[model samples]
Target: MSYILEILPSLLEGAQLTLKIFLWTVVGSIPLGLIVGLGLTSHFVPLKAILKFYVWLMRGTPLLLQLIFVFYGLPLIGSGALTLQRYDAALFAFILNYTAYFAEIFRGGLQSIDHGQYESAKVLRLSYLQTVRKVITPQVLKIVLPSIGNEVINLVKDSSLVYVIGLGDLLRAGNVATSRDVTLVPLILVGVIYLLMTAVLTFILRKLEQHYSYWK
Candidate 1:
């Protein structure tokens, strides 16, 4: 027990980094995902095609590969023009990868909206922005929240991937402890921490789903 207590602080520090990465990725990806979703569904053929290709490339690749490419490969390609620090590289990869997934989810949500809702918006003399904000956005949010919740849960786990680039995330911290002590307790603690975090997120997401359930 004393050994576990001794290692707890370092593990918490790593957890903090993991949380930061998750929060920033969520903030950066969600809006961009919405924009990309909009672009995918837009009438402009060229723009749609470009976004389609972007989404396909992002989704088709493994995020771990993307992280490696961003952190290790980009610097090689452009003479280091896009060199990012380890932390920044992880965030960049995570946001880009998740944005593609969220974009697809949002696109599906947006498309599922009844076409007559748009016709009604036009008849109401609502501008495009207003129509989207007032009519379409709510429905899309309700539809996509479940998927977004899934992604958010995945993000919590995926933040551990930052350890590959030496970011000292929770899993890495646990690994370090286990290596140093030659014991598995630290890793077990790490698992407990992850389960606690996911449990909280599940509760919050369920409440959100309930709040939005009133729409149906």
Candidate 2:
């Protein structure tokens, strides 16, 4: 117990980093995903094909490899390649990966909307952007919130993956503790923290789903 307490601060420092990654990834991915989803379903054939290929590439690759390539490989690829800061690199990989996932989720939500709803929006003389904002966006959010929430929880766990590139996230902190003190308790603590974070997110998203259920 004393040993666990001794390492708590360091673990917390790592947890802060984990949280930053989670929050930033969530913020960056959601809108980007929505845009990609829109592109995938758009009338522009070449644009749709390109976006689909991008999605396929992101979804098909291992995230760890993505992280490695962003942080390590890009710097090697060409003379003018931009080397990213460690956190920036992890953030970039995470946003790209999660955006692909969120894009698919949003695509499913957007596609589920009745075509008649769009016709109705047209009847009201709404522009495409206005129609999306006034009619389609609300419906998509209501439908996708639960799924998006699930991904948010997964992001909490996935943030640990950043440690593969030496970013020292929560899981790595626990690992460091165990390696130094030869104790398993830190791992248990980290697990509990992750569970708590997920639970809170679940609760919030459930409420949001209900709030948007006005359409139901």
- TM-score per prediction, in order, is 0.97, 0.97
Off by over 4 Å in 1: none
Spell out the clash pairs found in candidate 2. none
Worst 10 residues of 2 by lDDT: 74-83
- 10 residues in a row with least lDDT, candidate 1: 158-167
In the range 1-216, model 1's lDDT, one tens digit per residue, is 899889999999999999999999999999999889988889999999999999999989888889999999999999989899999999999999999999999999999999999999999999999998889988999999999999999999989988778799999999999999999999999999999989999999999999999968
Regions of candidate 2 where Cα sits further than 4 Å from its true position: none
Candidate 1 global TM-score:
0.97
Question: What is candidate 2's lDDT per residue for 47-119, written digit by digit as tens?
Answer: 9999899899999999999999999988888644778889999999999999999999999999999999999
Error of 2 at 99 (Å): 0.7
